[model samples]
Target: MKNVEPKVPLAVAGSSGFLPGCEGMRGAAALGVLLTHVAFQTGSVTESFWGRVWGRFDLAVALFFALSGFLLWRQHARAARGLSASPSTGRYLRHRIVRIMPAYIVVVCAVLLLLHEARGASATVWWANLTLMQVFVPYSLVEGLTQMWSLSVELAFYLLLPLFGWGLWRLRGEAARWRVPVIVTIAVLSLAWKYIPVPTADGVHHDNWLPGYLSWFAAGMILAEFATAPPPRMVRLARIPMLMPIVAVCAIGIAASPLAGPPGLVDLEPLEYAVKILCGAVMGYALLAPIVLAEPGRHHRILASPTALMLGRWSYALFLWHVAVLMVTFPILGVPQFSGYMFPVLVLTVVLSVAVASVSYALVEEPARRALLRWETARAERYRRQNGNAETATAATVTKASA
Candidate 1:
């Protein structure tokens, strides 16, 4: 992996240019999550077939994981190939923190301040979220935002990424050839762990844990591997125009069918549950393949459209605050469950979320991220200058001694 340039552009491909299609895909995923929560909140479509389809939007998390795996590995592999310097742990962590934290902290504090009466004023709950450890404790998991649990799961991946990349880096030749299968096997094991049925506090399940979703991440890693060193066969497969949409539609159908969602929830038997997980992972890959693999600007127009790009840019903030939007919208609009008002409420919720997210992205996330990056860059430059001067001084002393 280190010896060559990636034959194809990986997801979002670094600063040289953004993958507009991938951005659109991410925006769609965020919308899907928002719709899923809306469906859950209003008893509007829980029993209908289409309602079940909307509910299965929980699959968006799988997409999120895959994107993370693909993009992060691409960055790491690029560094390994000497396209860029390897980031120190602190610097890497700082980058991740600045990207996610400023907006997240603002949302957390805002939610607490606005909804203190509805949500308990527990200092521990505040601390848990501030540290991104909400998944460990039960109450904090759903305290400010139920969806934030996934963010915590993502944090676990962030911590594990460096070591995971190192392990993959150590393999050579035949062992490297086995990378995809090994990651797939691990993914299978992750799903299998959910079925073990360990005792837990009521309503708390293994779904919140990092292990349950490790396979989704692994699936993304597989895509990264193929993207970086495009096997001829895989590249050909990706180029097939109708392949991705067909697979994606089929995957969604399977998920929405009675087999996966009779009650607008994933309440299948153990074997069926495994099938659902596998299908969800497959769906994620199918949806992402074209976005990542298509010739730049040659893919679906909708994904690369201006609106999609704008939404995608704000997708992170959207994900963070969509639930809060719903919380506020329901009361402000006086939306009723299982009524015609639900659609308007949904529309209004999306609008409010997007508006708030746009402001937050511009005012908080973008500014903070840029400032932190600039600081890191300036620090590196200073260190380089000091080292260069020291080297010059040492060389002059050596020359004097020789003379």
Candidate 2:
């Protein structure tokens, strides 16, 4: 396909606006994650070549992490370059809390209260999952919410991102030159953290933690930095015909090989784990770079289409509800877990999950987000006005004393 540069340079866009097609990417990643879960539930992961491909769709989580990294870090990157100011720490945290926690809390409560398997869950389980701390505790993840491990990791990233942004901002004079390197170092440390021995209670997978997946996020952060200034080499690479799609295909192919480890719950050797991490980073970058860095093209237009944008808007709710929907789908279809009515079950689950997600978005997520954000804005404005009046009064008193 022919490549065109973005109409608005990423640096300018990074200040406040979204990179084009990002919503579509989010929608696609959410769907991929859903499909991966459904495949495992239906024993389709081990059924055939396509099944194996579906199993590897867990790579979508990497894409999700990467998208977060890129989008969230852009403003910070611009601030570091003195191009713009970052949000206040309090505002940032509030925004994140409002964006994620309300819908998540609703889902957690519904699952625990309504799901038969989760009905008898302990107080500790409720506490942990509600706070997104279930990944830290062993065997605390309840049924219909097992997929929340990644969400837990995402929350951890959200909490720490401001600190990371501050560290980047501190680079000052060296910020542009050192931004990518610093991020890469953190990513490397994250990978190395995987090899460090950490004691955990049985049933706890450290891989579910943010440290294990930080590299995937780092990949997106690096892309953010690159897109902000876009080196000539990167620009040329982006212009290459079919380059990104080829990279995406190759990365997926490699990730599907034995080197990336088995597509199951089996434990991975250190090497396999490392390979898998690398493959995920590469694949996520390949999938995202074009939309962020390259020009508008057929692929970009498709991703930015009205339908895809709608899916993206509801993606978070879709992700939150899909596993729960899948769990119930088994009973509704009279197909016991792993008994292989894969296709029909997938179709039904998608329909039901999408419907539920739409409702959740309309009735819960959007309203909550908008209300909180408006309140925050009004509070900030009032604070500014009060401060301005105080300063004006102080100046008047000084003038009168001088007179």
Q: What C-alpha lDDT values do all the predictions have?
A: 0.76, 0.85
lDDT for residue 338 in candidate 2, whole number 0-100: 86
Q: Over the stretch 1-403, how does candidate 2's per-residue lDDT look in tens digits?
A: 9998776543322334665488998999999999999999999888357866888899999999999999888877767767677768988888899999889999999999999888988888999999999988879987899989999999999999998987777775455878888889888877766687888889787877888899999988988887766765775676577898799888888877887778866788777788888888888888887777765332466788888888899999999999999999998988899888989999999999999999999999999988997898899899999999999999999999999
Off by over 4 Å in 2: 1-16, 296-299
Error of 1 at 51 (Å): 1.3
* Tens digits of lDDT, candidate 1, 1-403: 5797667543322222357777888899899889888877777556677777777888888888888887776655545444555557777788888888899999888887786433665897789777888777666755347788899899899989988777766553445566677778888887776577867666456657788778778767777766654566766676798897799788878877766636554446666666667777888888777666665456568988999989999999999999888877777887654454667778988999999999999999899988997898899999999999999999999999999
* lDDT: worst 10-residue window of model 2: 8-17
Most accurate candidate by lDDT: 2
